[model samples]
Target chain A: MTIPVSITVNGRRYDREVEPRLLLVHFIRDVLGLTGTKVGCDTSQCGSCTILLDGVSAKACTCLAVQADGASVTTIEGLAGDSELHPLQESFWNKHGLQCGYCTPGMILASHELLRCNADPSAEEIRHGLEGNMCRCTGYQNIVRAVRDAAETMQGGTS
Target chain B: MFAPQFDYYRASSVAEAAALLEQHPDSKVLAGGHSLIPVLKLRLAAPSALIDIGRIDGIRGIREEAGRIVIGALTTHAEIAASATLQSGATALSEAAGMIGDPAVRNRGTIGGNVAHADPASDLPAVLRCLGAEFSIAGSSGTRTVDAADFFEGLMTTAVEEHEILTSISLPSGSGGQGSAYAKFSHPASRYAVIGAAASVAVADGVCSAASVALGGLVPAPVRAEAVEDALVGKALSAGAIADAARCVGDSLDDDEVLGDVYASAEYRSAVAHVWVGRALTAAAARCG
Candidate 1:
């Protein structure tokens, strides 16, 4: 069966006929060609499929595309403007938060959601915030640093 | 993983959802999709239709009415974790919500879906049982309330009827020095509880007037330690007395059958159960003080 779903993604409204079984992650990646949102684990264990739904970070893999109809979603690719990088992205690059970079986009998006609500999250708070995201390559130390750095930058710190 | 094909209906209201469920007998309600999607991907259970109730209005708030806190069915774990009301009134529920499958899961997973799925390893069921929460279910007929103790039947099962949708969970206002705590040993990979305990104690004049203990992850469903509660009543709120009461969990386990998995042995889970009960009791006692 096909269902008409109209969703707003990254300030763009898209209307599409989707299958009931279509996952929100696949819809964002395959239908919209926003491949930045990676699907690491089909299971909800890995946070590689994290995305912002209605301004909150959530696992996109477990959410049905139809469930997101009439809702606002933001993927990793939608974080920055055309020329500028999001603060979290810049922090990841400057802090060497990524080793393989497979988990970078999701990590940045998750961190973006955290910093939106909490501009100055402590190290423990950042760790707790990013607990859902798994980064096998960087060992999480740099990820934590990148989030803290991004929080500082977002708070208008010169450095 | 691709989910199996099924007819999808986005229900705008509780009545619409109930009607859809009634129309399609083999349909499932999609809330957070944390539990159902996995089953669909695994092909373990396939429903003919999915009634997505994620966008339903009036099912997403937390409010206090009279002397009870009413939590809407679609209230996400993230909301609960950040809720000051829950933190102050139902600290155990807030702690358990915080310990759910991390941030992303907490942000998406709804409390309604968790309790409806009735997973043995879920931290909320035990805490709800300990707190004596009540569930409000809506159907074509009308709304009905079910006590937490009577709601859960067995493994991954509940008393929720096929046509019924769980709308909200209600917890009575704490009065007269009531304290509660939930403690769990989680699986490293999935973060599901291997053995969890939720304890609530009503203290008066430095003595325990009433106590309730619910154990999870060790059995098919969350079970109350009635013997322990009975033993702890009127006992002095001391570490030694709490320890003695916690030992009654072993007695409770002897009467009930406990499920064992690769993560823990029956004996090991029983031991962990005692430790968790002790920890919960200690925390609850501290809250009383």
Candidate 2:
């Protein structure tokens, strides 16, 4: 049976009939055609499909589409406004945070929540906060650097 | 990964959820989806219907009620970690909640769901066991409260009946002078506790007036360290007293009864559990003011 779900994705609303078993990641990629959120590990362990569910970071792969009905979702595609890349995306590019770039969207969104909670997090705190997002390519030193740089930029670049 | 085909129903209230469960015998209650959806995708469970209780209004916040801190069933681990009341009154629970999977997992996992899932290796159950928390369960008949001891029955089993929903959990307040801590030896990858211990102590005049000790991840279910609790009460809570109590942690269980895997052997878990229990107790005692 199909369930009717209305979700606001990247600030746009789309009402669709989704299977109850349709994961939010599939709903975003297949239904909405926003492919930036990668599915690294289908299991909950990998943070590759992370998204902001109502401004909070959550694993999209584990969340059913119906569970997000009427909820506001922010995907990697949503991070960039018309012409400007998000500070996190820009930092990832500038700081060499991505090699495969598969984990970039999830990393950026997860880091988005981390910086939101702790604007000026220490390196240890940043590592702890991004424990959910894993990148096999960058070895995380550069990813850590990118998040640190983004924190500085987001904090008005005093550092 | 996609969950197997199932019909979904968003339960607006507890009664509706119970009714849906009655209407669909193989229905699963979806709270946070941190545990349930993963189970669904793995096909470990294929419930025909999902009663989504994530949006249920009455079961969502933490508040003080009648000398106790009553936490709604849907209160997320993130909320628990951030709650000042929990940090001060129930430090063990808050810390355990913080240590679950990671940041995204914490934002979605709920204490009620965790307790209801009753994963043998979950951190919150051990802490809840130590805190002597009570679970409020709602069913078609009515609502009833079950003590933590009676709540977790066995591996992935809970006192919550098929048609019932755990609505909230209640913990005693006035724990300012009491100290509580949770210490765990977690698997490096999954981060699930290999062996975890939680202890709560009320120290009066440097003596342990009241104490509760519980252990998880070493056995089929979270178990109260009755011997440890008995050994600590009325004692000075000194290093020697704690060491003596720690030794008794796994005395109640046989070696074979404890869970063993490549991550840790049953013998190793039994041996290390005492150390964690001791550490948790010491931390709790140090927090007592």
Q: Pick the candidate with the highest TM-score.
A: 2
- In angstroms, give how far residue B269 of model 2 lies from its true place: 0.5
The segments of candidate 2 whose C-alpha lies over 4 angstroms from its true place after superposition are none
Off by over 4 Å in 1: B254-256
RMSD of 1: 1.4
- Given candidate 1, what's the lDDT at residue B248? 82
DockQ of each: 0.87, 0.85
lDDT digits (tens) for residues A1-159 of candidate 2: 898899999999999998889889999999999999888898777799999999999999888888899999999989998999999999999999999899889999999999989999989999999998888884899889999999999879744
DockQ of 1: 0.87
Q: Which pairs, if any, clash in model 2?
A: none
Number of the top candidate by lDDT?
2
Positional deviation of residue A33's Cα in model 1 after best superposition, in angstroms = 1.3
Best by DockQ: 1
